[model samples]
Target: MAEPLEIGSLQIRNVSKIFGTFKAVSDVSLNVQKGEFLTLLGPSGSGKTTLLMMLAGFLDVSEGDIALDGASIAGVPAEKRNFGMVFQGYALFPHMNVRDNIGYALSVRNRAVAEIEACVDEMLDLVQLQQFADRKPGQLSGGQQQRVALARALCFAPPVLLLDEPLGALDKKLRVEVQEQLKVIHRRIGTTFIYVTHDQEEALSMSDRIVIMRDGAIEQVGTPKELYERPKNKFTASFLGKSNFIHHNDKVYALRPEKIDLIVGVDHQDARMNGTVSSITYFGSMQRVIVDTKEGQKIEIDIDVWRNANEVKLGDAVDLLWADEAAVELQMG
Candidate 1:
């Protein structure tokens, strides 16, 4: 078993990547602990990929330096950086067998044949693809090919692993399966994983910490629960998860649909927003009720079937109230 990481530090200072006139990444600085699973999450054109590329030494910083374990690696080349990369597509050679593909890096470095064989087998075992050692990329399933790509990346035992939406091409069910596999591999190997993805659910499920970016800047960085329970702003709240933005005076409160529980309360004790249930949508395990309140506020509430069966009806007058603590504080920009 791998020992707990004595996590070296990663620091970036004033890193900017400007493409022509537009700023792809602008003066971004961030620190990540070694062996920490940190994900750079954002929508397209949010500079998350540019930041990852810079970290991998693929693109020039265009401004600042990046340090690993107190040493600057700014002048490093992509090959010399020793960072394993799993790109959006599984870039495996169609003609190469699984073992050969896994051992390709070791072979390029002129490692001994026996050593290369051992490393390849170990990586194959690591990804649970030992049985298909002789299979080529085309002969393997999509998930299998993905595992082979992961094994190839991990075979070299690099200090850092960079994933660029590695599972984006797979179907939803396969994506979930791969997510579990990747998390387990990270735990087993104890390597630093810097995952980049636009999928909020993916980031929330797999990462220890998520950096939410927008327009080439860091919007917020926190744990999944932190971002979900107490977001820093309206954008962070809305981006991280589902939010019901309630405009209250100068500040807007973000009340999560799951958090608005149904309850009976007196006029003074209960804060009620009188509304008519305009429509309802059946969403398998739960139901979504659209309620239009007196103050022209449309509140969308989700309730589990077992809990709120026939409790509220369409065009029926209902009182909607959320706990004061349940409404998280956020600023709407």
Candidate 2:
């Protein structure tokens, strides 16, 4: 069995990236724990990719420093950082077969030919691509090609692995399959993984901790459940998932769509509002109901399809009920 990596934590302190007049990343400080899967999540122009590039030693920092363990690696070259990078495009060499592609990194380091072959074989097995060892990139499917890329990146067992939207190119079903594979691989190798993506579900499902960024600055950082259930601000609440903002007692509060319950009869709870069923969208297993309240506020309720016993219809009057603790007060930004 291959030994798990002794990966050390990464410390990024007051890091910034500048492109002429544009500040792509600004004053970001974060700690990525050892052997943890940390994801940097944000929308376009949010500077997530730029930050990952700095971590990979591909981009020069405009200010501040990045250190692995206790040593500063701010001036280290990309090749000298000993980090593996997997890009969205899966940049595999078409001329090389799977075995050769996976073995390329070891060969470049001038390892013995037998050792390179053994490591390549181990990587192929790790990614479950052993059968396709002789197939070139042109002969493999997109997912298979990506596996080859991942295998190549891991053949030398780098301390850290960086992925920038590595599964973004695949279709939804294929993307999900690859995600499972990635999680499995991470567990087996126990290396530090810093992934970058804008997909909320992806970050929620895969990350040990997620760092949300906006406009080149850090917005919030927390575990997926914490970020989803107790977001720090309006931007995080709305961006991480669907949220309903309601004004009550002259204060704005955020509530999750799934937390609101809809009742067909008269309202009894103090936190109840009367609304018309404006729309209902049926997803498999669950459904979303949008209601236009009499107070001129729109509310959304998400419930299991089977639990929607009221069978509400469009134009029907309904009561939207939620507990007091379900509503999280938001700070105006």
Q: Which candidate leads the pack in TM-score?
A: 2
lDDT tens digits by residue: candidate 2, 49-102: 999999999899999999998689999999999888898799999999999999
lDDT of each: 0.86, 0.90
Clashes of each: 0, 0
Query: What is candidate 1's lDDT per residue for 13-76, written digit by digit as tens?
Result: 8888988999999888888888889999999999999999998999988888898877888889
Superposed Cα RMSD, model 2: 1.2
What TM-score does candidate 2 reach? Answer: 0.97
Model 2's alpha-carbon lDDT is 0.90
Residue 203 miss distance in model 1 (angstroms):
0.7
Which pairs clash in model 1? none
Segments in model 1 whose C-alpha atoms lie over 4 Å from true places: 1-8, 263-269
